[model samples]
Target chain A: MIAPGKLARLVATNALSNRRRLALHTFGLVVGIASFAFFLSLSMSVRSVFLEEIFPLDEVEVVAPRVGAADVDARDALNDDVVNEIRQHPDVKEAVPRMAMAFPASGAAMFMGQRMPFEAGGFADGVDPAYVADEDFADRFVDWEAEEHEREACGPPPERECGDHYYCDQRDNTCHKRVPIVVSRTLVELYNTQFAPSHGLPPIDEALEGMLASMLRLEIGLGETMFAAAMTGGESPPRQVEGMVVGISDKAMPIGVTVPIGYMERWNREFVGDEAAEVYSSIEVVLEGREAVAPFAGWVQDELDLSLADRQGERFATAIFIVTALFVMISLVIVTIAAINIAHSFFLQVSERKRELGVLRAIGGTRGDIRTLVLAEAALIGVIGGLLGVAAARVGAAAVDFAAHRWMPAFPFKPDSFFLFEWWIVAGGIACAVVFAVLGGLFPAGRAANMPPAQALSQD
Target chain B: MAGDPIIRLRDVEKSYGPASAPARVLRGVSLEVGSGEFVALMGESGSGKSTLLNIVGALDVADRGHVEVAGVRYGEAKERALARLRNVDIGFVFQAFNLIEHLTCLDNVCLPASFSRGKSPAEVQERGKEVLGRVGLADVAGRKPGTLSGGQKQRVAIARALFQRPRILLCDEPTGNLDSHTGGEVIEFFRELNERDGVTLVIVTHEQRISSAAERIVSIRDGVIEDESAGAPAAKEAAST
Candidate 1:
């Protein structure tokens, strides 16, 4: 048995004595590790963008079959009871009911001191607030009417200050109603890529997205539209409800606006009948994970007579996973080749150090000690090369990000950096380097250990 | 052969190459050295003297018959125990003075201690320095072997061999590469170690001057011991007694 301290010193001495050979062996390992880290980070980042923003894999949108479809029935209409039934399902994490505006409505907003009418009509829907609460800009996407009631209980007055995206009405000394609305990220992406270039508007950077939401003032006419005449013919002119863009969320409707359920229920009750307000148009069931999506969707179809609105999420997720795995497999092959290079380098090193190893054996070092010395030398190379490799990968990623952001066209879900440098990726790259290096050093260490001590004695 | 036997060999044999045609280096030779006795093995090249010395030092094994060093039987001992035996109970001084060229003289001296577990480096260093001082190369402890003269390098090798305070020292022509004066000086050091410390010594040499200092000389030729005689020092010591 050799002392650990002495063994380390000997390993360092031997490994460092031959700097040129050490550098050559380490270069191969570094390139392999860097490739591994870069590909894994890039694929993971792309997969995250696809699954999280483009088509969320954990949520399934359920809707009733359209009227007059084969085997359709009136009992398939989604309501509070259906929503509760789906929510209480063991596999469902959350089930948020959504109601579309039954009557025609239109909206206009003041932008850059000019009144701009929404030419597509107000195709709006309302959902439970929990669906968008985790968004980055969700701090203000609350129901103002419900917040006013909660504030009213705290005694209106100098003590109560207006919350974010709200205004204190001086005349009543109470928070007046300003309906908060959220637009989908898809709508923003469409405007950025399609409309911004033609209209000569500066592209909106996501860093200032919160400012974009707070600055827009939208006014929706309850029973009026540019597309059609009001359905409620007995209406005494259209009532206008003022709303503010509180945030943008992926959970919102892709081509329209979304508001808190309370606002939709109230507006629907006032404009249409109580029946319209009570029936939900759809329910977004958020499952525990991607694995739960299939079973939960099946349960929804079998028990509640609801079908998924789209199956694109599951398909997209599977495609991303396969692509990521393929890239990872390619990286692993590169690393294994580098490991073979390491083994060749070590074979030469052991051959060169034969006399030294034999001399060590003569001085009472056992075969195990000799083997450990060679392996420890290899491990040292691994640690140094692994650190350098990860750093090279980060540098490579930065260069790629810089080029992409500067030259690539603006598109949907285009991340600022294509690579995501998570902690595990960096650590895993280093660990893989070390494991491969040790595996490469095994046979050479054994060769060095088994060399007879008599050879050293017979020398000279 | 003046004390209890510390090294015993009986009909030991060794050969190399394939069994179809073997080159026998030692052929059923037997010898013994008492504890604290200074003996010399004198032979020509290919005379099996070095092979016999290697078997005595636990660096090589006999093909047949019994051999023992101190109290441990060589045939039955495992390699780990043999390594410890070579590290702690026996020391080897080679003719080439095979000090590692990259290490300082003191580091080379401490090499043996590094193999033995539980010895702190500071303690090893202190012992290494002491041995270097004993070999009169204390000032050269920090210098690499390449920078030293042949004499200094041999002294360093000797200091390394002495690092573990072994009871038996095996020298395979320890002075073979040195000048006459340096070789004589090394022989004097061996004598002093044997006389003052009572350390057992088995030196293989052909030099009559080196043999003159030994108590007895065993001459070998053609893989077999041919003659054993009391040297001048043994006769002188016997007359004094």
Candidate 2:
């Protein structure tokens, strides 16, 4: 029955006397809250990691090998003929055909227990060199050394300088050019995870993945002079060149290495004859943006009536939520423990202030008044502890972000952050702490209320 | 000629510990305290005088009795009603002063009104300061009890009890902790408040010097009232009033 103002003052007066206890309770709450917040933020970040995994650049592929078709052969690919046809569609933004031609590349260096090898005949995707220069592309090729190596090549163009991405493979002085390929971010992740452990190789990040791609070199015949003689009767040998990785892309040819269209054309002209651009196994269609892709992809599937694969990006979001919810539930136990600590502290506080409480009762305060005063004290503690805990969690989350960015940059499924604190998380954390603290305060408040005023007053 | 008894008890009996051969604190004692009377209860250390005061003040229950304060009967009053009656109708001053050390003198005086609920904060503070001035501790209103001397503390205690102008003031050895001069001064002030303000004063004391200052004295032995005397001018004046 005490008024709120009086209750607050009473609570404040009593609480003000015990700074050390206040700090201790708040510290306990902070630990519980910070951990909960950190975990919640981590879960959000992790969910985004999976979402970005679908198409790192918001681009989905129109997969090949239709549901039912005849006379489809293994040599079929996303050829230029299919790319040109898709580009003619008014809805289509750009269609880039992806293909890889056999080429030679070799160079290896070990760093941090991993061999950074420039794969011979590096997996290549034929892309437009102009696309490689776009802002979205981070140069994966280490072209700074190309000019230095130019001075080291046989001589100038008149003297038949060995072309970029190629080198003399023998004492015969025959020179081959290196083809330029683009690396896929997905491949980098695969190498770090699926391949790194088995090969005794350490995982590489964006920088290291780019470095490995840059170091690669490839040639058309892998330095074989007999490639022309080994060709079909009318087919000619493709010019050998060193293939260098020029850039990395979001989506890549899933089956083979990537190279620019020029390399694919020249290789096909020599190895498969001039009719190489007729059929394609896979095609990638670019639409307007986030707004146009899903509809465009669906339209293509319906209009074209081909078997198209659209990776379900949001399906896993629900499953991840349930999992994250469970994790959040587990973290709530920490808050409960903090509440228990608060309750125990209140118990001791009530016992400590028994005589004072008795005096209050003797001076016209009702039993309810006494209980309310105690609970009010608890309420204040809950609020203070809850807010402090939330603040500490924010700091902890930032620390996690800093550490992750510094140490784990090449981690697969990377997002802007590995820990995210949404507004709900912070608000919910504070509310939960206060509720728990009040829950903890109830039993002791009741006990103090039920005590006989005379007996309590009689206590020294 | 005394006014109708505001506090009336009929055959009040109280005991402590075991029911069989219990140490009887009060036995079949009946007393009446009228409005505007200054009465003293005198007894030896184990005489149960304080118990009688506590019962009269609605602070303790009797084992067997019909007790009434301000027309609220003991057996019928709810705990809340009893508490409210205590707040609005009766006031108590214990030997310990019982002042909450954390609160300032004025706040201690305002404490009773905090429970009264209907009183505004401004009204409570104004009345508290007025009562403090009545006890001549108005200058020390903001000082905590711990900062006050024993006499100043007892006066502050009296001022707190006098808050809201209760009909009856029951003080148990209110001057018990003060030196003789300070104790005498507190007693004189109590007499003046009783005489001038017509506040009913029931004081329990063991000292004859203190008991003699009252208009009437009732002496108790064991658990029963043994003697009663009232021959003072104040009692005569109260009887005429």
DockQ of each candidate's interface versus the true one? Answer: 0.55, 0.36
Please write out the lDDT profile of model 1 over residues B79-122, one tens digit for every residue. Answer: 88888888888888989888888788999999998798777778
Error of 2 at A179 (Å): 17
lDDT digits (tens) for residues B20-65 of candidate 2: 8799999988888888888899999879898898888777789998
For the second chain, the TM-scores of the candidates in order are 0.97, 0.94
TM-scores, each model vs. reference: 0.85, 0.66
Model 1 residue B169 distance off true place after TM-score fit, in angstroms: 1.5
- What's the lDDT for candidate 1? 0.83
Measured by TM-score, the strongest candidate is 1
Best by DockQ: 1
Candidate 2: Cα lDDT at B2: 45
Per-residue C-alpha lDDT of model 1 across residues A240-318, encoded as one tens digit per residue: 6667887777788888889998889877776776887899888888888888877877777777777888788678778
CA shift of B39, model 1, Å: 2.6
